[model samples]
Target: MKGRAIAGIALILLGAYLFFMRDENISTGSVFAYFWPTLFVIPVGILLHWLYFGVFGRSAVGVLVPAGIVTTTGIVCQIATLTDGWSYLWPGFILAVAVGLFELYWFSGRNKALLIPINILAGASLIFFVAFSISNLLGKLALGQPFLAIVFILAGAFLLAARKSTP
Candidate 1:
């Protein structure tokens, strides 16, 4: 891409970001301010790439990386903004990685090797998020026998999901 085109695109995106931020009343000085604009740029980038490649007759699975990362970052930022800290939102990154891997596996001709790690990341993210939520809500209750049983059940469910997703 030419420098002028890139600059124009950047300016347009910046304008849109500023407009939305103002419209939504989201603080520009918030802790997540730095990452918020990415939610806009990343999706636009993905769509532009797809239009240039996919609609033009070619497409690649690599597009999913940015798509997943941006999505995960947006989710994490929103959650963190609400929670007032990073806290339990870190699992979002794992889920994003799993999303990327799953997209690759699905779009890149079902490469079997990607399935294992995708499942692992997805399962671990789910399990971690659940544990974090339970622990925060139940505290001592979360550490008792019932908690373990719930974890076991969730783990089994994760395994089953993995099995189902696999070819």
Candidate 2:
């Protein structure tokens, strides 16, 4: 427990540093700057959570919880980026969520079937998120108006809620 706590704190501090200190040449301004650091912290958090469960809890759920948190965080950050016109870090965020869902399914014991629908939704969400991000980045498509972001958020929320409601 102590180790997990320490790692969590370290990850948070690292995220803070990245958010506050990283330099970007993208010219998107402060909003993009603010999000760049999260690109680093989200992955570190997932790794630390994996280590924590592998060493301490010895339970798959332990890893899943932290990984899920990391995924959710990425979703949140990407939403902010899209809505606020912040530099689109959507690719990183999508990758984080993908990894998180993979870890969740991979670590889940025999109840894997229970996560199927949730995984499907998460997968779809990832696809849309990535597509939207890519389109926006390439300047080939406009950012999804208000409704689209809400849809993604709500879908992510439903997946999370469903996971929580399950065993």
TM-score of each: 0.54, 0.39
Evaluated at residue 39, the lDDT of candidate 2 is 59
lDDT tens digits by residue: candidate 1, 71-151: 666666655654454656678878978876776676667889998998999899999988876666665454666777898
Clashing pairs for model 2 are none
Worst 10 residues of 2 by lDDT: 85-94
lDDT of 2 by residue, 81-156 (tens): 5346444544444455545566666666645674675566567666777776666765644544665678889999
- In Å, residue 32's CA in model 1 sits off its true spot by 7.1
The TM-score leader among the candidates is 1
Candidate 1 C-alpha error for residue 121, in Å: 0.6
RMSD of candidate 1 to true structure, Å:
10.9
The lDDT per prediction is 0.66, 0.60
